[model samples]
Target: MKRVLNLVLQSAKPRTVGSLIFSRNKQKMAVSPSLNSLSKVPKSSSPKPQIFNLLTTTPKTHFKFTPIFKQSTLSLFTAGHANQKPTIKHHSNSSTRCLFTGIVEEMGEVKQLGVADHGGFDLKIHANTVLDGVKLGDSIAVNGACMTVTDFDKRLNEFTIGLSPETLRTTALVELEPGWKVNLERALRSVDRVGGHFMQGHVDGTGEIVGMEMEGDGLWVKIKTEKSLLQFIVPKGSIAIDGTSLTVLNVFDDESCFNIMLVGYTQKHVVLPLKKVGQKVNLEVDVLGKYVERLLGAYKTS
Candidate 1:
């Protein structure tokens, strides 16, 4: 028993310590070339064993270190496309329309109005707050009608808009003359809080201011429009007059007239009350009503 114990203790002693053994079908066990190099590294030079080369002893089996980034990264360091001008794409349909909240930003003065060299009418308006960040081809509502900014002058605080033939035939913008004040509002952005109802700045028609009277600190104004437009005007519905949003108080279908009460704040901000009776004002009814009418018409036709 003592002799057997001594033999077992001798066998337990390690013949090879901290050595990795690799096998191919268990026929022969061999140390990998990279592992052999790691074992050969001086302990004094490196606290731990280090691999000098990633290649293995077996030529058939090659181990290579892949790059952290690929060739696609080369474009990031190149400047070939730096000077290229960016292209702007525009839609040809109604989707191209810009939306507004019917909240007038400021009143702009008609500085100059004349025929443009391009055949349309060019309107130069002197404005202040509305010109901030306004660029060429941007849309601005003039008298509740959406017009594109054809040119601008930051120094003069003025901008020019082109009025097309269709605009002249549809709405009352043609009535604007030099020194006249027009309601101005910028296109709504996604981050902006919607203060009033949605307005497309597309004037459906013009309405005549038939009556105006003072009630308390508010102003009671009545406008008479055509039957075609009066059908869309409803009590408590939203209506934009000259780019200022107002709630409809009463709609007299028999008289083809509707009234709205503008608070003191609204009265001072808008150009509606400043105008006298018999003057035509651009009118845009609630878009929802127009959409409903179209949907019902489709069902009726079917």
Candidate 2:
């Protein structure tokens, strides 16, 4: 019995060495020879051990490594990594993106609103200061909504913008009528000072004016919005209403409503004061709050 066990142990030694090599690089390995032939591996002058590179494999599985020095970026691509061609998506009417500071530059009047030839609505607004140095494809925030300038007339001080179905569904701009006033702001420039909190000119949703009253020289305004949006609106937080940056005074979570104050100076500058109860206004919650919530959600899931 002792002699039979020794023969079995000697036969299993070679297979163990072959498996060690396969586990190190995860490559197809062949059966190795016994300990008597172990010195057959070639010696190298370099002190470092040899490392395997996958690029030397078959053409279809080969990958390329490119190092960019400008920004210290490394990119890797392989033939088998992607089976389909990459595609880029573009909006039908707009081609550029812009950001705002939630500061109303002027009050633009709605001159015309009609359907566009290529689906969606075409809006024409009459404005003064926002048109300065404006180009045909420049972005303009109308009522806290970003819109591309499809056409502009310097002499008439009017510009045309195309609105998609998504924009109409999310914003109060759908309720606009001729002669109605809307807050307008040109995209912020690198040199311009940030007078208000950062805004993307993307309206989260529309809120209806539920209550209003005068508090000495300042006016108190209450707006009722969707309950889901209340999580982002907190007392003493920043909010954008119709492109006007205002600080929230109170948040009635139970009622799904919030209140903000408009000083005498602000009342004269923005069109929010002109809006009466039951009127719909574009609302943008603080972007930071949304980002925090998204990050927390990722942690919870993980």
Candidate 3:
């Protein structure tokens, strides 16, 4: 019994002992190679090699090491792909469109054709929508609302977006008479740089422009919203008002309202400066907060 106990202790001390034995299909067990054999292994030179091969023990079997490489400052980023530009893939269908980043540039022209008898408005389009891969029949966001391009002229940089009766009823766009300004953006592409939080041109609801005053080099806009909408808003969180993505500066008065400071650059660029108090604009709360709420709800119930 004492001799058996000695063997068990020796087997447990792998570093000091020579062999560890167990029965799988008890046969001749190949003892593990000693640390001396690894020390004798030649250094590897393959760039970003995941496994270290000391020596080819056989034609098929190699002594692979998945352990950390003992090297000084190994770079994970390689110099080879630094200059390679990513090629943007184009899709002919609008449904599979990439919801990348929203566009702020002044591009695309929208002209009204005669109002349809069915109660929608037809529009003629032509303008330089700087976004690449904008094929005809693709979707574009006009003034923060998604619109489908009915026709286009590539050379002239023109396309058309039609507004249905439902769109006019739900949006402040109904106020758009002849000769009004709007911001236009093509549907997001996969390669477009994400400069802001994700926004879908769906227009979750609308908020009124309550106040606009000069604070710094920009204008401070205070918007009044439903208490329900404000629940999803947080100070420094992203919210899209009037289709323009802006960060909330603060939530005021029990979260019934919020303020966003627009820099001079944004104020000058967007049609937001043209908006007036008591006028309503589209509002889309950040999608991230809702997803987080759902995930937290799952844990709470569990």
Candidate 4:
């Protein structure tokens, strides 16, 4: 049970100093250096002690020392001492890594060719350009929903997401048929410009497409949902339709119906336009509204 320790001494022509020693009898002892060993050190007349370092082979183990110094003193421990091991703790202020803002960049279709035994649909996403920096195990926002990557094919520039039973129940993806167009967006990166509002890829509710009207070069899509999800919608506020971030142009039907504005560029890139007016679409709202509500409740309680 021996522990290694290093010692540094700054001394001039001065009285002999002692080295730290631990007795097996559970006592601390200070043993001075032998005269023969002290005589080997160079004699100095300076008022301050010259810096010297030593690694001694003491027979005793488990020792700690604090060397005195003219300027400052510090105590250090070698790895040989094993009293406790460091532990990692979870902090509330730490980043919640799974957050995503709905900003669709690509489109793909669910193919029955490579469907897995787990009953998950395969998405043939072409991610070569926008997702060039994407790595395995990263989450992707699919149709305003979050899905984890299960496999990747670098040659084909494709990835697979295995859907659990829980996902099929809550999301509009369950209605996806073969060759159905799907909106795709990678998880928000830290260096991203954040062109859209804060989103978590959480499909709080599903909405049914009521109608689509052409407005100039863009298109306006009307959506109807339950009242439970309607309270979060606001005019000119943010909303993600089929994973594409857009603003709510208007809210009607006691807040159950909302309108989304899709510019010509967005209409060309996203898959939402491919679907008909009677189909259902995944819907997600900005998470900031929920946070504000939570803080307001806390204040009311206080």
TM-scores for every predicted model: 0.69, 0.69, 0.61, 0.64
Candidate 3 achieves a global lDDT of 0.68
Provide the overall lDDT of each model, using Cα atoms, as 2-decimal numbers. Answer: 0.84, 0.84, 0.68, 0.70
Residues 1-302, model 1: lDDT tens digits: 55664564476652334543332334544444333445763433336654554344333346745443445566786548768877689764231478899888999899988898887789999999999998888889999899988899999999999888888888888888899999999989989989998999888999999999998998999999999999999999999998888899999999999999999998888898789989999999998999999999999999
Lowest summed lDDT window (length 10), candidate 2: 17-26
> Which tens-of-lDDT digit does each residue in 74-120 have in candidate 4?
22453434577765886532123555566677777665434567666
Give the TM-score (vs. native) of candidate 3.
0.61
lDDT rank, highest first?
Answer: 1, 2, 4, 3
Q: List ranges where model 2 is wrong by over 4 Å.
A: 1-96, 117-119
lDDT of 2 at 266: 88
Q: CA RMSD for every model? A: 14.2, 16.2, 19.0, 18.3
Clashes of each: 0, 0, 5, 0
Better of 2 and 3 by TM-score: 2
Writing each residue's lDDT as its tens digit, candidate 2 over 83-193 gives: 767768876433235678888888989999989777768999999999999888888999899889989999999999998899999999999999989899988888998
